[model samples]
Target: MSSPEHKQKIWKMIKDIKVGMLVTLDNGVPRARPMHLVQDEYDGTLWFFTRRSAEKVFETAGDQDVCLSFSDQEEGVYVSLSGKADLTDDRELIEKYWNPFIAAWFHDGKDDPDVALLEIKVQMGEHWKAKESKTFQLYEIAKANVKKDATPNLGENEKFGG
Candidate 1:
């Protein structure tokens, strides 16, 4: 696990890597999909979007135990957010983070029947060697050489952007 300072840097890296590839299991089969996260300040909820018919929708249904992976290629930082997924159609939340680009996903834009929200309540995660523990230039050399297991262990229910 990382020291307090390193943990802070990892949090920031997670915030930067907002777009995660969510991994789920469907009938004992594994699946991965790229997802965009919307940070909610009200309840500190993590919000994501997807189509109703997507495979993830089915997999995340019976059980939301899933993994969200984010990485920074340049900085060599990786984060894995493991959590349980939940489906919701919260109108207020949809309106709060609604973007015009989302229109393409919904015929009703904000009211599309096929649109649904996937909320991942974080459990625990792992983060790679970030720059906080070393000089900005030297961290990469050290991190690249470190083994995956030795990188860092981030414990349960950690939040980012605050």
Candidate 2:
């Protein structure tokens, strides 16, 4: 299980990523697609909006296990989350997460029956963060080389329940 502090850190890393690669299984083969993160909070779950007719819906029906990967290279943060995906047509939630930007895809707005929400019930997550500045990283590298030490601190590597 993740402590509240860990969850907060993970949330901060991913909240602004905006886009993530959602991976699902299709006929036992891995298929991935870029998905927009529609919600603001992390809290052990993630929300995404998608068309009901998308292939991922069928794929999830066959296999609930999925993975979401988020990265911000400039910030040196990356997160991989494993979860079960569920599709919902709850009108209230659809409206709650709705925005003008999504209208281009749904066309008919909140009332569109084809618009579906993907709720990922995250179960496990792993994250890597490089907390050092560029100069510090360079210094560490040089120190390691001079000391003939192969181990270098590259920040935190944590695994926790989502």
Candidate 3:
């Protein structure tokens, strides 16, 4: 279990950057695809809309362990999350996350048989955030290069959860 504060911190980092690359093992090979994160709050779980017949769904059914990678280059923030994924057709959950954008895929809307929820119960996550401006970061790198014995201060790196 993760603390509420930790979940909030993760949510704040990812809220603006809503898309993530979800990776799952396929026949012992890593397969990855972009997924749009659907959520209103963070509770140690991430949700995405997926078709019931989607390859990711099938992959998760075989191996629940998954990884999600999120990045915002402009903000200099990157996060990697590991979790267990499962597919569900629960009506309430489907309705809760349904949006007009999702209709583009599920033409039949929330009631569509193909519409399903991909729930990821996050177990661990690591985030790297750069607090300094890019210009300053560049200067730091140059200074480090001149010194030869120093390393650039890029930012803070934190690991949370199990």
Candidate 4:
């Protein structure tokens, strides 16, 4: 099990990254698509809205294993989440995560029968975050080169599991 601190760190790194690359296997071939993250609280589960007839739905049905990647290059934060995906038609959850922006895609709004929720129960996650500013990073590089020292510390790299 992941510690609360680790989970919180993971959430903090990904919260601002609204878009994630959801990777699913299509007949043994890996396929990835950008998905909008719907939930704020992590709690080891991530939710995404999609259509019932989407290729990802069929792909996930065949194999539940999935990967979600979130990156913010400016902030130098990257997170990779591995999990199992389950498709659900639960209206309550759909409504909970629904927003006007998402409604544009569903045509019929919250009542759209084709609306499906991809519930990704996260099993494990790895994260890399750079704590220093870009300018500071450049300074470190220069200092390392001038002094022939090892590279400077580059924030954190961690792994967590639920």
| All candidates: TM-score | 0.71, 0.91, 0.96, 0.90
For candidate 3, give the lDDT.
Answer: 0.92
In candidate 2, what are the lDDT values of residues 1-162, reduced to their tens digit? 566777788789998998899999999999999999888776777899999999999999999999999999888899999999999998988888998778777878878778999999888989998888868778878888888957677788988874
- Which 10-residue window in model 1 sums to the lowest lDDT? 153-162
For model 4, residues 24-77, the per-residue Cα lDDT tens digits are 999999999999988978788889999999999999999999999999989999
List ranges where model 2 is wrong by over 4 Å: 142-148
Residue 22 alpha-carbon offset, candidate 1, angstroms:
0.4
Q: Across residues 44-125, which tens digit of lDDT does each residue of candidate 3 receive?
A: 9999999999989989999999999999999999999999998999999888888888888888778978889999999998
Best by TM-score: 3
Candidate 1 is scored at a TM of 0.71
**Candidates' lDDT values, in order?**
0.70, 0.89, 0.92, 0.90
Candidate 4: minimum summed lDDT over ten consecutive residues — where? 1-10
Residue 149, candidate 4: alpha-carbon lDDT? 58
Output the TM-score of candidate 3. Answer: 0.96
Q: What's the candidate order when arranged by decreasing lDDT? A: 3, 4, 2, 1
Clashes of 3: 0
